[model samples]
Target: MSDVFSGVYEINSPDVVSEYFEDQAVILNLATGHYYSLGGIAGSLWGLLIGGHATDAILENLAAQQPQLVEGASAFVAELISFGLIRQARAGAPGMSIDVAWTSEAPKLEVFEDLAELIAADPVHDVDLEAGWPVLRPQS
Candidate 1:
């Protein structure tokens, strides 16, 4: 509970995206191009975590629903942190918000390492460099 994120955790931006199907989920880290799949009660916890629940509350709620998950949930959360999917929320910085259909089975967060290169690029960038916008005049 003393982890840096105990205060708050937000999804790493410009780097991650998540989609859920019922209680299952697919998460993509655009920067690394690595996508993750989560399901069971773990996916449900993800929804709460991203929805702005502090770590303690999420763990408490989920652990109450599925006592066996008390051990794995922490590990899974650590994985999320290591994968750069979630991090300490900065003051007033909004965390991820998603529509999650809750489930109460078990907890698990899976990573697919081979698909990074295949996932199409998400180019997040600055419009202006050192000075002004580069002219995009059409050929004429």
Candidate 2:
């Protein structure tokens, strides 16, 4: 739990892709076919965590920059954990750059977990030859 913040975490899957917006981000898990949208301060935290900053260090930086975040950072990171967006590493990861860019805003972790069912079926393999693409029958 707290280990997600006390130690080091990294994106363990090569299939994961992230796209950032102004203060939000969308992460896609190609393998699981699940997409996630991270908004508010959760976006900033995602960049730092993936950049290899240790848990405590990121918390320190977040606390220093946005004291308001200190209260809920743990729960947010836990959410990231449950979503499988981040994983603990055997050793502390390097590349600790805490100078994350962005204006301070209220911190909240909003995870959109409704994409799995939409993407779990393989279009290329599961679609009917007559129906073509965009015609997958949802996997059960």
The clash count of every prediction, one per candidate, is 1, 1
| lDDT of the structure predicted as candidate 1 | 0.66
Clashes of 2: 1
Question: TM-scores across all candidates?
Answer: 0.69, 0.79
Q: Scored by Cα lDDT, where does model 2 land?
A: 0.72
Error of 2 at 85 (Å): 1.0
Q: Positional deviation of 61 in candidate 1, in angstroms? A: 1.9
- lDDT of model 1 at residue 40? 70
Tens digits of per-residue lDDT, candidate 1, 13-74, equal 76788888764788998888678888776777676677677776666555555666656777
What's model 2's lDDT at 136? 68
The TM-score between candidate 2 and the true structure equals 0.79
Q: What lDDT score belongs to each candidate, Candidate 1 first?
A: 0.66, 0.72
Identify the leading candidate in terms of lDDT: 2
